[model samples]
Target: MHGQTTFLNWNKERIALERIKSLDPIAHGYMDTPYYVAYSGGKDSDVLRILFELSGVKYDLVHNHTTVDAPETVHYVRSIPGVIISKPEITMWDLIVKKRMPPTRIVRYCCTELKERGGQDRFVATGVRWAESVGRKAKRNSLEIISPRMKDKIVLNADNDESRRMFETCSLQGKRVLNPIIDWTDDDVWEFLRYYGCRSNPLYGCGFKRIGCIGCPMAQDHERLRVFGRYPQYRAIYIHAFNRMLAARRADGLPTDWQTEQQVFDWWVHSTRRRREVEDQIRLSEVAI
Candidate 1:
């Protein structure tokens, strides 16, 4: 009988380096910019940043401030050398009041505004892995041409076909992505980060599995509750935002079941009764020709 252990030593690093080197021209041609590495102060992103350095590739490390990011995360992001921190004009609190609705799982406008706005019309590198989510595996590929919305995405799974024609189209049409670590597993990420001597974010030391915005809608209920427990101030701030949002809705003459900020908070985290309330309001706002 032949016995072999699952090898942690994979050629993924070499593959990633090759991808970085090969995609350099296309990235520059797309926007005359070096690859924009989206650094979110997470382990995966840290690994990618190190990999970019190892490849000696021309890339800029960029971090977008969500305002609601954990203090540890903000400090960690700022600590990274040469990382450009992009601050949004409006904060999460003001955004809620302006949108007149709290960002939910289905309607995550906060992510669109804070996180996804960067690297537009440019070739970007991300640490997104299929191991993170099933949706990522389906939606992302080695080379991708991403539209603002989901419908027009062109994802090419083949790294072998580094054809200039497709890249030219991506440059002309929408943002292009070069995701070298798309297939890496969680273990792969940790192994690479450790190998590169990157300690990663301080939150990880506190037994936090995922590092993201304090109250990101996409996080699980338990994770959200954990964040609220850890940072009680955020809960108060969100409630205040909700209060202003309710006022805005009332001024616009939009009827709602929630009157108090606590009630909105309850609905935001737990209540399923008025789940469609925000969507209904959005539908009503759409002008019919």
Candidate 2:
């Protein structure tokens, strides 16, 4: 088993290096203009940054602070050398109030506002690997372009099949994205990290699988519960956001099953799937002032 794993690691390394070589034209062109590394202070990002260094590529590391991230993640990113912190214009609470509902897996406006900010015009490299999720496996590529305008268009006309296709394939000439580790497995990421002796985010030491936004809709129940247990502050913030969302919903005449703060919080974490199972339409609209 050890021998087979070693062979697989070597093969993955070769493929990743080849992908990096293929990205040379884009990387080299952005050399003087400061290419960006979308660092998340996770194991995957750690490996991605180290790979850039190992490959003799120069890039700037940027962490987009979601304002709902675990305190430990913020502390870790701040401690890293040359990490430029990019903060969202609005906080998670502000976003929830604006959207009139908590961000579910399907309606992840928080991702657009926070995690996906600040890489609009320049070339950005990310630690997006196919092994991470089913959606990423299908949608992500080794090289692609992500235009905010295109994404917004898709979000507006989300039901249009052609618009979705266009959004998936849309790219501007010269403004681009590079996901050099798109094909890497989770084991491959850890192997690379171990090989390079890189220090990971402290959350992993506490048995967290990934370091992401605190109470992120994308996280599993166990992950969210762990974070909420360790940081009551986040739970309090979430409860506060839920109260605000419920109030906005009430004012807007929206009908919802979420009656109390606990119910809303529980529904956000546990009932979204059940809710979606019986509905084909969005129950709540964005609250208008």
Clashing pairs in 1: none
Clashes found in each candidate (C-alpha, N, C closer than 3 A): 0, 0
For candidate 2, the TM-score is 0.78
> What local distance difference test score does each model get?
0.82, 0.73
TM-score of each: 0.87, 0.78
Instruction: Using TM-score, give the best candidate's number.
Output: 1
Task: Identify the runs in model 2 with alpha carbons over 4 angstroms from their true place.
Answer: 1-11, 14-18, 25-32, 148-175, 272-289
Best by lDDT: 1
lDDT of 1: 0.82
**Predicted candidate 1 versus true structure: per-residue lDDT over 104-223, tens digit per residue:** 888889998988778887788888888888888778787888876667778775367555356654534567888889888888887777666678899999999999998887777778
List of clashing residue pairs for candidate 2: none
lDDT of 1 at 284: 79
Per-residue lDDT of model 2, residues 1-289, tens digit only: 1222343376776666655554454454533455588999999888777777766655778999999888888899999888899988999998998899889887888898888878666767788887888987656666665444565221212233464344334544334666777877888887777766666898899888878888888877767777788888889888998898889999999998877988888877765455665563444332331
- Global local distance difference test of model 2: 0.73
